[model samples]
Target: MGSVTTTEQDLRARAEEVLSTLAGEDARLREDQWTAIEALVAQHRRALVVQRTGWGKSAVYFVATALLREQGAGPTVIVSPLLALMRNQIDAAIRAGIVAVTVNSANNDEWDAVYADIENGDVDVLLVSPERLNNPDFRDRVLPKLAASAGMLVVDEAHCVSDWGHDFRPDYRRLRTLIVELPSGIPVLATTATANDRVVTDVSEQLDLGTGEQTLVLRGSLDRESLRLAVVPLPTPARRLAWLASKLDEMPGAGIVYTLTVQAAEDVAEFLTERGFAVRSYSGKTAPDERLDAEADLLGNRVKALVATSALGMGFDKPDLGFVVHLGAPASPVAYYQQIGRAGRALERAEVVLLPGREDRDIWAYFASLAFPPEPLVRQTLGVLSDQPLSTASIETRVDLSRTRLEMLLKVLDADGAAKRVKGGWIATGVDWHYDAERHRRVAEARRTEQQAMLDYIATDECRLVFLRRQLDDPDPTPCGRCDTCTGTVWSDDVSADGEAAADERLSRPGVEVPPRKMWPSGMAELGVDVSGKIAAGELAGVGRAIGRLSDIGWGTRLRELLGSEDRPADDVPVPSDVLDAVVRVLAGWGWERRPVGVIGIGSRTRPHQLEHLARRIAEIGRLPLLGTLPPVGEKPGARENSAQRLAAVWGGLDTAALPDLSGVDGPVLLVDDVLDTGWTMTVAARAVRRAGAPEVLPLTLAVDG
Candidate 1:
């Protein structure tokens, strides 16, 4: 079955035989395939089919339209995006004697006649893109005619409806409204070659589909055995060209060389052609006829290779693509999967090479940031809105942007939920500046985090194919035997010896640990101090570790002596500069600390037993035990009880007389929350204690704050 269908039995039989003849030299079909094709045609309404790329997805709908028309079921309507694809489908239909017409940006007048035919039930299927459904002319005139005739609505690339998808188009969201407004309860047939779990949910929701009985007929294998994977590091332009040349000499079949930009494609194609290779360039700027010519030349082997952008593979299918090369890294794993899928369509052995360098990391990081609206720009855009609705043109003047850039910015603003369009005018819908600043700040941080995650994945030493398979949800995949690491052909030594290491192993370890510096024997002790902007459990634990290690190495007694017996004069609290030096000197000697690069961490070389003991001591550093209750205010007891009472009394008696007039203070107040078992509690406690003492208190808790 083909997209070209016929109303007459003899015509359909002749068309099927004709398609079978064309496919005889390429792909073979089975009886079950026709059964599946017939099942799809038999549906009275629109249906969705989830199948793999090479599964002959086009045939299902084409055959169905022909069968229905032959049985007097009237016409079908298709909305598609690509003009080239439409022509290809229409030509196939014409060959089968099935009546079909197209409406695209290129031929507005022709659509009128097509509409007339569709209204009279003279056509079988109407193919269309989601974008065309939004045109006011088509919506007002064309759609009503087809609706009156009870035609089926077919959406190709249906995954575009999902915002989560890589190819989302805002216009796709409007299809739901169209589907709802169509007559005869117009059923939709949504089809796509690639979709993950999230994409599947989006398809169902966007299409208004029933969950159980009205679901799609999913078919096809995820595996494509003919494809081979390879990675070649080309850190320099010269190295990249040389490697590409070598690949061309090795792989004989026609191929695609994908790059990040038009310039790269042009450069590579020119370079190859100069070397006596049959090569040509294809990019977004290439003319439609020229592009089609290039595609046909590549398919016929008249062109040895095509250096192209990712756009080259979307609609055209060349079954004998022997290789697909990535001249640069794709923006994402998803993009990479799609670009590489273009290869090996004939199910013959093929190769895919990814040439990624250090520059790619920065490139992708920059791309991620681009998706987020910058705070300054957004704030400026909001400031110009004047709290009034305005046409995009008027807003452009107020926003001080050229028409083109302003339109682009407005679209981004809308996507970010920062603005909205209503009543033929734009309105600022982003949050109020005062409250939304914090939210926007968080979003910025999230973008940074995601950018870091992507960088980490690229630099990771895991199997590349496995990572891709996981991301795409491809099933039962073996490590791509052709990738650099698997084939032992990689040039980068960054890949560790371990096939798969534990998470802890990913944590970079020091070459070797050094012993803590010895503390000089003297009256003076140095203390290091660092203040936190926010309190956290992890920080407290780290502080406990540093303190316990210090105490274990014999710095505890000296530390306790510094606090003295009674509350010091307000002015007597040790200055941070004085205390910081003493603490640093002492810790440096205790084998517990080392400030390397910019961060401090526990010395890994510390004796296991000592480290374990230190860990245990710091575990409860911040926790206070239940000290026994005190006697009434005046009644004194034994030394221990008396000491506790004295402590409580000093803190309790702070009221009237010339007390440090600390009221109405707005700054930080350090509290003596608990004791310190390890020095951490005392060190941290000292800072807090001094801060509460007034403008700042030095915390000197008896126990370490773990």
Candidate 2:
């Protein structure tokens, strides 16, 4: 193959030919699409495309690849974000006579074969995920070769590279390094539909490669003409669920029902399916095979809807999707628009509705709490990393962070050159890394602003599309005449009485299993704790029960009201009558082989009275003795600390000597608490009681944080 010089007209014609093949015989390139292709194939310049979904973003890259490969350029290397996106792009590429192969977490076995194809010039395009950019082997071995010989580089979902983006991914930040290392004169394209002005600027700056050249940014209208946006504010979770159960069938066609969490998605899907609707729950927890099957089902219109989270956000291309309904408001209007954009892309009309809940802000706050850790934690993590490589599991033992947060931090550190992930594990690079406190603070403030914007969107009477477009800083914001507000066509908020009763019944029946921690967190020995490996079964608390999760739609609202900080003076208030009754119901329904002979309360610093009342009531109802509460030995750490740190703070904090004579009770003891968040408190308290001669401990709580 030889490099062939082609005029702008020739490149456009070739791009149009590929577009016709990929889309259809009558398909033609949009003006912006041709401009992007011309910049890539004819002028060899960088471009950033911020176009609406179904605006042929993928087509731009596919067409450009066809034209570039015709002139003997290397295969187009696309860094996609999700497996579903990769799969869709590969199929689309093949339709245009482009041989595309993907290397993602799901296809480890095919990597070598894919590499062979790329090396032999049998592949016109190669799709890799952002996370792949930092893989030890891929980064050290494959990336350099691919970067040097790449005809063009593409970053899909490029907004993710900007921390200000609604869905900021640390893995995507590593693309900056890749762009810097790429050979000069090769065209690069960064594309996304959800980036606002800030995200576009951030992503464009990152794509510059220090060339002293401005990126060619092509941004189109954010408005979706075919969407009919509306908000249906239901007063309660039960009402919302009931409304969905009744109104879902009336929606136009097969589409997606978005939820804010996995549990919500599953609950909605189950409720709808029980009501005779064909819907399936799709989340990150969904099995890979099941996800593929679900996507196929929706595409084939075999299922009415897929109740999903952001896991199904980008890369899904369903042209005729008739509706999109959000069960809860997203934290950002930009993100909401991106999700609602999934509908009516190629159709004349699609229904988009948002059912805002009172609990949406609480959910948003919980997720917002997972932002980058403080500097002290980051320093502690780096201090624990030695010259010797430590696996993530091993590092996790020393760092008091959740596995997800730990991995994210490690990725950011690696991208900043402060650490390296190798085959053995991760190693500190000894580079001086400074925490960008101001930047992080700004980002957090931006999140709060976006959240407020989302709230405003739900309350506004103006055009919903116009509000969302304004939030994204669209150059020409205008009212979409099809929206509920614009057309004065409000969706009914009426839920049948029977439907509401059924939903209430589902929410009222509560008892979530609380599984005990089987193993002590690793690296406890370094903290002067003697615990490690599997916990002794005799000392472990049996599978316990909670009235509900703090995040559940059912009892979650009540629990939040009880535990929320609206009234600090009420924190120690006695357990409510309804909660106490629910506790009794949970006990009556408990399937324990040996009923508790005594009830013991875990000492609570903030709500001791609540705990005592709970224990006394349970003992009185079950005809058991009310054992005394465990004595506090020391101050416990804040509730937000990691598991290891939490354990360390509470290791010797429980005094077993305070327990009443347990020798007379040679049976399972019931452990009562006001609430369970980390389970560490329960674990430590149960161990102390068991060691104090209780044969077994059965833990129960009013609420558990999911």
Work out the TM-score per prediction.
Answer: 0.57, 0.95
What does candidate 2's lDDT look like per residue over 546-607, in tens digits? Answer: 99888887888898788664233346677788887888888889999997888888876766
Best by lDDT: 2
Cα TM-score of candidate 1: 0.57
Residue 616 in candidate 2, Cα distance off native in Å: 1.1
Model 1 residue 38 CA deviation (Å) reads 6.0
Number of the top-ranking candidate, with TM-score as the measure: 2
**Which segments of candidate 1 are over 4 A away from where they belong?**
1-40, 43-47, 148-150, 209-214, 217-219, 369-395, 399-465, 480-706
> Candidate 2, residue 670: CA error in Å?
2.3
Clashes of each: 48, 0
lDDT of 1 by residue, 1-706 (tens): 6564454345446436645533443444444445444444544444556555566666655665665566566576766667766776786677555777887767777887877777766777676765566554676667666666644567776766765555655666666656666664445577776666667766776565432235454544455667666666644544566556655767748889887666567666876776678999998888888888898899898987888986686566777888888877776565577677777877558877777654454345434534424567557777766446767644543343434445556654554446655555667874554325665476456445444544444565565666666555666456766665566765432322231122112111111111111221111111112222333322222222122111210222223333322232122233233333433333344343322111111211212232222222322232322111111222332211111122222222221222233333433222222223223322333222223233432222222311
**Candidate 2 error regions (>4 Å):** 1-6, 393-399, 565-570, 660-667, 693-695
